[model samples]
Target: MISGIGNIYADEALWRARLHGTRPTETLRRAEVAAILDGAREVMTQALGEGGTSFDALYVNVNGESGYFDRALYVYGREGLPCARCGSPIRREEFMNRSSFSCPRCQPVPRRARP
Candidate 1:
């Protein structure tokens, strides 16, 4: 997935929430989610900007299990499942192997810590 694209999507969603006069709590929740996506995108851009170190072949420790280097996109695919950040059912995965997990009720983006 395009990092910039994902960030943009998140930002747009937050903006929509705010413009719609969503509940204060819900608005804050959206903002937090945007932050998480933005932060993740920033991390990706910074790491890949060098264009030397490929995200592939990198090993990520998920639940203490070291998953092999596949692609940076995989990080977000795990949607609609239990968010590693919060124990909430995540949205369904949009792309393969890129499950997105977040308890919109618990792990709204901004509240999530940097992974």
Candidate 2:
């Protein structure tokens, strides 16, 4: 499940994979799932290299340095900004009490599963 991926990386991975976070896992093709996982791994690896994500003064590393990954983010915290891939504005929605960021044009809402 993609639940434990945290809001930041989840949004980043979804943007990188060009997949909507609302898409049901069971509805995804194996190749598509693989691509998403790969994208997540790639983004996490890059973030790790940059010392991870730091939102404010509360989040800091051992050396009390803030993470630089925030600067490299493409979607998270960029609501109303133009999407990197498409010119459409990035949108932020409330999900599970947290914010979910995505490009409406690039990552349209997945259709609901049939009953």
Instruction: Estimate, for each residue in 10-112, the C-alpha lDDT of model 1 and write its tens digit.
Output: 3223332322112233434555556555655555564455342544422222223333212233223445545444455545423323433224654334433
lDDT of 2 by residue, 39-101 (tens): 789877777777544433223432344445446678987999999899899999998788899
> Which candidate leads in TM-score?
2
Model number with the top lDDT: 2
- Ten-residue stretch with the least lDDT total in model 1: 14-23
Candidate 1: residue 77 Cα off by (Å): 2.1
TM match of model 2 to true structure: 0.83
lDDT of model 2 at residue 108? 90
TM-score of each model, in listed order: 0.31, 0.83
In candidate 1, residue 18 scores what lDDT?
23
Which residue pairs overlap in candidate 2's backbone? none
